[model samples]
Target: MWLDKESQIDLLAYSPFAELITNITANERLNPLTIGLFGRWGAGKSTLLKLVEKNIEERDETKKKFVCISLNSWVFEGYDDAKSAIMESLLRTLMDNQPAFEELKDEIRSLIGRINFMKLGATAIKHGMPLVMSAINPATATLTMAQYFSKTKRKEILNDIKQVWNEKEIEEDRDTTVENIRLFRKEFSDLIDKSEIDNLIVMIDDLDRCTPERVIETLEAVKLFLSVPKTTFIIAVDNQVMKYSIENKYPKITEGSEDFSDSYIEKIIQLPISIPELSETDIKNYLLLLICELYLSKGVPSIKANQLDILLSKVKEDNIFVNGIKIDLEFVKSAFEQYDYTILDKGEIDEFEKMFDIIGKTSDVIASILKGNPRQAKRFLNSFLIRKSLAEIYYKTDRTFDYAILAKLMALEYIDMNRFKELYKWAIENQKNSKIKELETITNISRNDEELPEEYRKWSDEKLARWLKSDPIDLHEKDLLKYFYLTRESLDINVSVSDSLGKAELMVFNKILQSKRATEYSLLIEKLKENKDIKYTKILDALIEEFKKNSKLLKKMQPLYICYSEYRSEIKDVLKKMKITEINLQTATALCSMYQADKPGFSDVIKSWTDKGLAQDVLDVIIQEK
Candidate 1:
């Protein structure tokens, strides 16, 4: 199927990668630069590299010649083999386009020979083959060459090369092989240097799939063997893998040593791009567009643009992370819907729910795992689609949409169940009333809807609690608080007086008060004061209320309070002027008692007020009692 082009949702969309590419391409620098594209496994580093390559190729006709060589080091057995494969791949590309590369043919061929012959004699000896025998017979040599370079033989050759090529040998070949390699790299580099090509960007992908030793070797080859001028290598790799690779490849490079701190490899790289989580809008948009294209391609006339938008919008609103890096949940949902096997008639809200169920569960489960990284989100969704497709074919039914199968798929994705449990607990226990409200909406949709099966619907708080009690996962306090607040918001639940007494509630309340948009602070404080269960002294609550009401005035009158130490006495006078009674004090005290505090005067006032009748005289006595 032909893929439709849309806005690239990758590193290039991020400001740093975009600017780095633009700067490198526009600059006149002759020195080659290396950049490490780092993120966890499943991050879209390969996609980003492809985008860069596309941009480079589009500009090739006008500016410089650009070639993108993507080598998966994991495909090879060792570093030397990977390097040879990478070199061979580049040479083959040039050789294939020999008409265009005629001028650089000799240089390319010479570089290839240097790489091929670097350890020829040693490899021959190690393989227990006569070195001169194959060298003498051209016809037999060609057949032998093919046999010797077979996959298994290639590994042997590479191992033999590494064993024989010591530091001295590397130093000896430094002038011829290294120079030619540099020149070979320069063929592409010089094109960028002379022409309008923005960059000669080589993307190294799938490094994480390689053995640690092979990974290190590949990196060392890039740094030491292929360090050339006027080029840029964007490596798609894992951060931890890169670290291990560097340390293993160059052991002498320690943390504190001058050379250690600024390793040669590290120095060549100007930008180290760490792919962050995608924003919710971006993710949704990407999914929505992808789904639209897929449906149109499949000749599905039922899916309308507006309907798609509505479905996507709802998913985005419900499934999104509030504060963390957001990606459009709607887009992801749309993708699942379009690619889903069971295609219902258009405008079928039930079908929509079914698709949403799949998307929501997948998103929630994967989100719990990757915490909403767009790349990971896409990876998880794509994998689910594949598995579901296979299941549909195998089962001869739409059991692919089953929640149990979905859960199994999620489990297979390596989603850390422990992490999910911890996050869920934190969400439940620490979520604000507002956040709870939002989560409740999702729960309601999941529960009240007929589309979700009864079994899945039965997975409620009690079940969650049981699961937690059994597993005993530790919930991060901050995450718990955030979840609690958000949950409350989602549920539209008011923070009760009882809730205000809880440590978690108090922490969140204070945090909200200190927030930038604290217009509700006074209202919140008033509610807290009114809550009988809040047992803190009323004086403190009253003082806080007064502070909220006259915060600006208090700031202005701070000097007045300092100048007149007796100014505090006016509080009682003001109460007297307002005709506030001992009964009022008793009421405040009773409310405060709900917090379990003992206040003698408040108790005495309450007892007296109770004994006195509700006549004017009693009212007057009550007023004057204090």
Candidate 2:
């Protein structure tokens, strides 16, 4: 019931890698080619190599063997010496590919032994080797000399092997270091010839996953020691990441000269082939194929796995190879339309088609959100399916889930988690207040005034509002809420619920205004008063609307009057947003009554009003109240 690992199927048809393999196999008698299979991690570079390996193996048995060796740099990163470890892996894999070459095995073993352990900071001392007495300092040597035989015997022994270290010796030591590398390369070339393979394709995958040091070490070893005749090193790594690794390895070169590090990497990777991102068509086909696979696995009624195979074949047939080049998606849709999906109900088939269409339409958006990464797409879909399966298992009822709605929400969840939580909370609260447990009542209905509950203010997110109003699917709020509760990563959703009571009160006030009949303002005030923490200033925006529509309603709002007496700071904000012209007689009277009782400097603020009549009217209303 999940999208299996990458390379489960050649979703892109493996054409690119097949061509690459063909080219590699055909190119003979050339020096070792270091081809960089460049792509971001999880962009299917490893999968491409797997397909190439499969293609090579499936080639004509009579032809020379394409000795494919797959190396994961991440695996060798943990070793003491990444350089030595990589070389050993290469030589060992080459030997394993053709173990019959006993003579070549000895040469490889000897060459591998020449790998620089000291340079990699690994040595016998580090591996529990006992210290030799002769290597000890003069003081320790003197003590050892006494313990062994005598001081006289030690002087004779010291002169026999001890020689003065000099500059010439250091020069020779440097030469030996260079000579060992040349010797190793020579032996590597001979081993390749002895193996009797046409081309030794060393596919190094996950180089980007290793630490910078390991990456630099492995690449350095490949270029210096292992780049020999008849070898093809296909390195899968991101160019930027490798560049960073190179810079990290040689900071002086990176800081002193920019092109120096770049040139070094460019020289090592002779043929760089970047793996392209999955196109929109490619993602659509991938998702559809995966959906079909899940359906088949679950033995869902309409679509079978074999039918999907037929669909794939149909698409393949339509892809006419023009000059050995064909667009893969040119016929996918046509094949989908023509495929007879058995005796499944037309309605069901139409539903699936709609699901497919929705996914296809939103493919680009999803790709962008996931950075055109096929693995992330698969993970998101897998997560959705897992949640859906869990929901079915737990509920085990006749309740149905809409794939389209869930897909939309899943994309939102993948993009921004907090917004998704807010939307889910809103939907759940909306459905609960609507008193509708059935899907029919929840779907295709506008929010009525009575059904709208006091907002927790958590759902006031503009993005959430836009997404819900956009109506990507005619979703039942109850179904979405159920999915939300099921799919949430956390057990408790209320932890992040907004504590602000202003937005919640605003929602309640908006609902009251939207009421067809005049809402009983007293009832709304009672609801507001229940939460004594309500700040009048925070919800002044909501009050402005009520004042405009039905000014008398304010007189009946005891809770708001109490807030006016308690929370004075909110008064200026409410006053600033208010219009003197819109202040009806009753609302003016209510404000005047508050000014009389509170006497919170309402006179000075009102005296400066531009509209003399409106200001004088309010002043006169205050006198009546007094």
Candidate 3:
């Protein structure tokens, strides 16, 4: 299996992002810079950061060489304080990079030892942190102190901190903590000068993946390093997640205050860079290259790997993101003469060449529905290849497979799962009908023919009709065939995780089910209309039980009046339990307004309510709706 991780070199084309980093790193400035690479998860932010690091290394010989340190804050997030994780990680990395600054390291370690890790929550909530002190953590500081000094010396240091706490001159331990942090920063700058490094570039990644507390703690820790000269910090994060983390961390911002999270992030991330989503062309190129790489690794001899690499380099350099490039067989043969492609028979060469040709034929169809996401495109290919392999193994035959229909069906399944479910249902229903002319059409010939729900109606004619005629090769075993094998844990293709309601949606529906306030009625009515596909009984049963438990809610059931048609009999049962005279007349008004013109017996229903002893106010509402 291919590893989905960042490498130090040889990633996809990121010329635009690399150029921006190159420009920023090469310029001279007096103060430190905090640059951010913002994009969604799997949008290639981490890979781009690695490429930028490669670029810096390659170009450093002509300019200043940077001491680059890579720090993933999430790795140590198991600890109590996120700030301490960053501080300890940064210190260890700096020490590893510049072993010559032993004396300065000792002083920094001593200052770190002064911090009380348990007291950080109060400090962070009150004033955040001071530059040098903010990076201090109790766990790491204690560990580092033990490493550098004796047990007796460590106790003395602890005693001094306790004495300072008792003095009360510093009202909060925060003041002393800030002083120790400041001293460490001064010593750190001296260490940098002594090491003769041009600058320190710290690459911080995976920060957005941390918890809300960790995210806020990491951001606060980073602020301490911003004032240090000749330092650059590159942070990778998703903006959406960071915004949510900020809100979660500080839930009670002042009512009229500005957006606190955005304001704080703006102040910290000086130069923010975003990675754009993949384009259609980019996805096609990525898919083609990935498949070719797999083929070269598996089928071809080791020597051909070099040939394929050369071809890939040229293709990327020429900016051919599509798969329709003309092949020069003569040029390829000449180039591979040293490797032995020249010695192969023409038949073998032709077979090898077909691998490249197949990509061009299928790229257009695959790219159209993959939505320009490289990861999803890769997943589709993995699924297709796996299913193809399984079929070959199970049948024990050398028969050729036609992947065209499977590819189209897979696209439908990935893009819109519910549509695919309906298509699959229709395909199975007509699996035995082989005659193309006799196949059922989506256009109903008569009103008596069963009509699909509106959700399935829109996709039936275009996506489903074509498949009914030319179905998958395994139509005889269509009932057992696994079309959605790649995405699902089981072989069941008729259902999927996407078909279920999400957590937020379930919460909204449950709130509507038990709500008692009259003002919530409008929103409840809208929610019912929006979620019409969900079983109406699922909602009605919940409301019916809630009303049975709390009779007062029966009066505020006016909003549910719009949805009575789905549960007419059950609603009548609920109404019988309560006197019609006690019912809210506004509900009758709403019902008449909605159905008086279209419904046949709607006027009689209104007159029946009055005959059953509805109030004068209720009669007036019925007259107006009439």
Question: What lDDT does the true structure give each of the candidates?
Answer: 0.45, 0.57, 0.57
**Model 3 lDDT per residue over 44-146, tens place:** 7777788877777776643234666778877967877667667767776665454434446665565355334435444433333332222434433332443
Question: Which run of 10 residues does model 2 get worst, by summed lDDT?
Answer: 164-173
Q: TM-score of model 1 relative to the true fold?
A: 0.46
Which ranges in model 1 have alpha carbons more than 4 Å from their true place?
A: 1-23, 61-67, 78-80, 97-102, 117-199, 251-265, 278-354, 361-365, 372-379, 382-626
In model 1, what lDDT does residue 128 have?
57
Which pairs clash inside model 2? Answer: none
Instruction: List, residue by residue over 457-551, the lDDT tens digit for candidate 1.
Output: 22333333223222112222123332222222223333233333456456544543454432454344334435565433222323434443443
lDDT of 2 by residue, 523-607 (tens): 5654654666554333443463345455444554334554434333334345544567755665666667566655645554465
Candidate 2 achieves a global lDDT of: 0.57
How far residue 256's Cα lies from its native spot in candidate 1, in Å, is 9.7
lDDT of 3: 0.57
Poorest 10 consecutive residues of model 1 by lDDT? Answer: 469-478
Residue 205, model 1: lDDT of 81
Candidate 3, residue 463: lDDT: 30
